[model samples]
Target: MAAIVGSTPTFVPPHVVPPARAIKGLALIAGFLRNPLEIVPQDAYEQDYVAFNGLGPRFAWVTGPDLLKTVLLDESDKFSKSVQIEFFGPLLGQGILTSEGADWRWQRQVAAPMFRRQDLLSFVPVFVSATHRLLDRWRRSPAGTPQRIEADMTEVTFDIICATLLPSSDATVGLALEASADRLQRSAMWRQLYVTAHMPKWVPQPGARRIRAAVRALRASVGALLTERRRALSQPDDLIRRLMAAHDPVTGASMNDEQLIDNLLTFYLAGHETTSKALTWTLYLLACSPQWTVALTEEIAEVTGGKPVSSDHIDKLVLTQQVIKECMRLYPPVPTTSRQAIGDVRLGEHLIKAGTSIAIPIYAMHRHQKRWRHPNAFDPTRFSPMNEGDISRYQYMPFGAGPRICIGMAFAMIEITSILATILQQAKLALADVHAPLPVARITLHPKGGMPLRVWVP
Candidate 1:
């Protein structure tokens, strides 16, 4: 009965009404218990894009590009990022990702300069080096036999993040940091969903306990690293050092150790998880579509002249970019986004009351029948500049959109492209099994069972 664009407000059905069903308040909890990523039918997108009413009172399910624009752009001020992302507060502290209003703006300002084009360019060698290290590890495996590669791309991406953002000593702390990160990410997913399902945060739930433990471990590790960096006084230009030295423009105060740790943790967590999942999906897609793999191989060969792929050649790998984009379309790492209404607002015809949550199902929107021509098909051409012109901006938001869009967008693209280019150049991969793997959505959408692949020399 909602009024959105391209749809009639009045129902003119001349058929019998569907049977009534009981609403399951505990549906999300059950789903979490099962696999934490099982798609519930209640949460499934229905005709005209209506799904389950969110956990918040009077919340109406919002889907599709038009609704996404309304929430993310048109009525942006009425929506706050804090309400939807409160789950991150406990783990990341009051960092930029979880902050709102002026505080968030200031944090963004200080961090924005660090990810500029020049800084990103300087980090290219770090990416190149990490990729080469990974390839070397792969090469060490016995010859002729397919190497069973079950790498956690999260670990790989985290290694690169550490190398680029901090001093070399940070790499020594990487293994511990990575273990804590994985535990935190997994526990956060479960706890956030549980809390969203109306479970009291104070409850001594197993997931909540794990989340707390993970958060504590992460903070301790980051704190020790920050102390070491401050003491060593090395790598003045690195991100952690920069944050340690940043001054508040308005207040003329610098970030204290706690604030610095919080911001660093936020960046470290976000920087790697999404990009890692993206690379995992990209590799899986490459395995499924060998033609694309062959094409990517040839492109890498021509661009690198059979030499090692470097960040300088990243921009030239257009086909690799397309392949990554197509993979994102199918298995977006950040598959869902939400906002909380600050005042009564009318989205289409649906009256969303104050304090109501507005969920934009990026996963469903990307796969919507009317939105994408071949919604389920793996087509890299969809991202080609010539063909991309026809796609709506809101329809393909892997990193999100509008004023609060992801600040790490450029960094992520660079990492994915560079890592993927290097891998494809030196290796030939095949799916360990013929059956297509289902995505396991935790903090990010990951392939179930680690995307096992048989890797060999190209």
Candidate 2:
């Protein structure tokens, strides 16, 4: 195999197996904070299953491709998402991400139509326009100016979300919603990591007051918007409008204001955060691998013919898409997923007891030894047309797999490709710091401090 980009003395963290006696309460969490992949035992890359005993629960982190399929695809019903619901239900309410059983089925059906391929393709103009605006802002900062790229990506995605999902919303409300998502995510992560989930709400914890305030502000703003949209005689064709019209097919029932609010919040949080983080990490990898950036720029030029990229040109920009795919493989936004078994289940030779938390360690799986030729390296060629048939379906799940896969996968791909093409078309970005940004896992994977990249016109 050819030498992949970022294969030099770059910033890939090494996974290590902690000594038997070193595993203790909060130690794993602390280790994970230092390096997200470091917490995974080195043996997990080759092993089918690794049972971990923690202060909270006894869960098995399974890495076998077939075993992963069994959990995420084949036996999804047996492995319910009770554990995820417990972690995210408060912050997200009864949204799709937190709901299960009949409620989950109904929510998925209601939300499915809005993300269809045609509808998602219709969002291209919004994405390209947002990227242009972002570049305009960057141009004003002067050539070679150091900027926190992650925050910029977040701001750009936030704008796109507001334009496409809530066109009627103003800047002030959008800011409130953004702040609410950030606060609630941090608060929820802290609770999941350090504090007990069963702890009473009255028991004061870190960021409790701020979380409360942010949640209240977010609810009030979205509720007010819903009320105003309800009064409008004619509304624009956007997600808010579609959601307002969506009803349960089986029951022929419409969503009440609370359900509407929950779904809206879910879109805002998921859409804005995941897309921005993915872009951030992609740029980080680009900085470390300038050759791939040059290749992507050339591909963009040939596809656009030196003009602004449009929806019709999306398929022609294949290399740029591969770069984004490899970036997600290296640093998936939602790093790990855990599911609780509703009943006893047998995974291969092991018998998983009822209620056991089954962890599908996505990050580990992407880089597992048994999966790819060069799992740890940045190689977009792995996803090229000729190599697509060689890769296993379950081995590359950035957006997850099965019926519960991410609904926004298509939309996210279009958005990422557009934003990346637009950026590479005009400017060449390079890492501004000598050391790499430390990878941190919160609600989403983020660079610990921020990504500062030097932007120069190409």
Candidate 3:
């Protein structure tokens, strides 16, 4: 048994132990062919943490509540967000999502005021209206036919984010923004997989070109919006205006055009992708778990009573939130997080050197046997407030933990629940296929073949 820090003994599995070189070699090869990342199962009873390569000298994985606490809470400063995320820097500029250190803190402070609870309350109607539009669009589609639901969800979320975050509503710009987002995601995934294979970032691969083109298009669109917003003296109650008006309180310097564009793009990309994936997965789970779906339907009906799902109403639908939580647990959109060690550190008995790339595999952690009871089962009850006490804090971080946790956590939760409730109010959905598609690890965890479902008027 390997001696690990903390109260309990930490044992490396047989696959990770003897013949370490062989395992590393296998991972390297897989990187060239597919994604270098592998989702591993953690222990069933004690603690669940999955370890994988963090694309640098360090070997990284997620496990045990104590470990999560150390990474997210206790020793957060020891780590920094991976430089690899800078692949998005060109697209997102120095936006909060792609920045670090002082820059991140400054932008976070500026953006924080715009996302206050009161402001979010005002945006509830935007969410409800967008969802209603989506439901209406679905109703017009041919019935009993397999609908590529993922695409629809993507469009719906994109529109909501655009309406709520941007200054203008020109259909042309909206369409371009949506197209750019799609292209950027596809390109980023290609780049991530290629870089893991040890390919250079500047390689003129087809995927690389696509990514560049996507970024260019997105930049042009955002640039136009920024120009318009700046030229017009009067501003609206939206994220764009807030960002434009934001200034570093201490330095009193405002963000440049480039910074504004990047942050705006970041919000659209990060905000939409995660929310859409969560909603899609929630629908899939609801399809497979009819009992839960029916119960959820009853809850939605009783709570809203045919009213649209406002943010206030979203809170009342506890079961809907649980369903979303469970889906996120199983298929967290951002399945892995990485950080580079700023200095040498001790993780238990393991002496990790500075510059090591640490990986926190949320996917593996969610399914680890030691951390979860019946790890493979889809039981929303596990997340119930009453039942959640048994779970470790670090063991179940779907939105991540600590200071570096996702900034848009509350926004995403409200968006997902609101949209899902709106859909339930208008339609009943079923999976078009008998079996769910296998999960694929992209930049985000997505269904390989896309989520196809049959929608019928309720």
Candidate 4:
């Protein structure tokens, strides 16, 4: 048994922060490139908070639950976003995720209703249909053949988002959308590094030209679709159509074409990347813990009762939801988020001065030794009915917390929960590789190569 387990490669080792010192200049950037997860020194974990004096900027890594609340939730306004995030501007434009102040408020208000419970409930069928399509394809392959689970999840989630938001797009258009987003995600890491180094956007770095081309293609495709939708005699009540009709209650203003394109790209990129990563990690964990897989499958069998999953049936899938919640806790889709102080801010005993960057290390926070018992262990029970209440509101922020929480939080949850239920109901999954996949951080956390798994009929 040890040999079978050992056959797979080592799990990506946790990066330990080097001893305290003045880490600055190119050394700082090199340290980050080596392992983004080691965002702070080992002492930071013991202390739960630490400040660093470095060349490029003065920053603090805050992991204490209360401190995170002050930075991300309570005193959020005092902490604006860091300039480093502008690396995404080329791909995301000035969408809600990147916008701030009144602009963010207006966009949120205009698009809020589209993600309400009732609206998401309407997407249940779309989720199930997309999952079934993937299952159909998987069924044709040999039962024990290795499958690239990461790519599979990415394709399915991408398809589901397109179906829900752009219902009229055909397979050809769907492929184009996928291609464009893939180009951006594949190149995002290097682009972020270049931007962080203060390199100009038009410097024509190695792959920058291709990435720019992909971004332009994506915008053009979305723009063409929007134009076509406008010319249609009647429009479907999908996300795109609804956004076109939505108006800001305060200003009574509607989103123009440019605004629509930016928001659509934001929704597509955000929703697609996070959901796929969540599903991939969930499956990997379940593969490692087959007993839990059996438990989840059994629970699905009981609740679903050999029928399709519906919105009404979702509420009863208690254990299934817990499994996903636990998976997210162990592997948050968006691993880390940072903010910069706009002015001097008092968080707990420390005074963070203006122009300082604050790292809300969500990845470290989830596994902080002081915060969660056996923080490294995989235990879905932590999120079970009886134990969930014990967790601090700020401690478990997979979709983040407070006002700037992910707008697609509800949509992503419903989609992930429904798809997990639907897939596990029809198949049993096992990791194809003997070793675990390495978790590499990019724009989102992804398995280094892909999550290879074997699918079989139970």
Q: What lDDT tens digits, residue by residue, belong to model 4 across residues 356-440? A: 8776667777777787776667777778787789999888898888799999989998999999999998987887967666666
The TM-score that candidate 1 achieves is 0.89
My TM-score estimates for the predictions, one after another, are: 0.89, 0.91, 0.88, 0.91
Model 4 TM-score, all chains together? 0.91
**Deviation of model 1 at 181, angstroms:** 1.6
Q: lDDT scores for all predictions?
A: 0.71, 0.77, 0.71, 0.78
- Candidate topping TM-score: 2
Q: Rank the candidates by TM-score, best first.
A: 2, 4, 1, 3
lDDT of 3: 0.71
Candidate 3 residues lying further than 4 Å off, grouped into runs, are 1-56, 194-206
Clashes of each: 0, 0, 11, 3
Q: Once model 4 is optimally superposed onto the true structure by TM-score, how far is the C-alpha of residue 381 displaced, in angstroms?
A: 0.9
Looking at model 1, the pairs that clash are none
How much lDDT does candidate 1 score? Answer: 0.71
Compute the lDDT for candidate 4: 0.78
What is the Cα root-mean-square deviation between model 2 and the actual structure? 3.1
RMSD after CA superposition, every candidate = 7.2, 3.1, 6.7, 4.4
Q: Write the per-residue lDDT of candidate 1 for residues 158-190, one digit (tens) a residue.
A: 888887775547555667767887787666655
lDDT of 2: 0.77
Best candidate (score: lDDT): 4
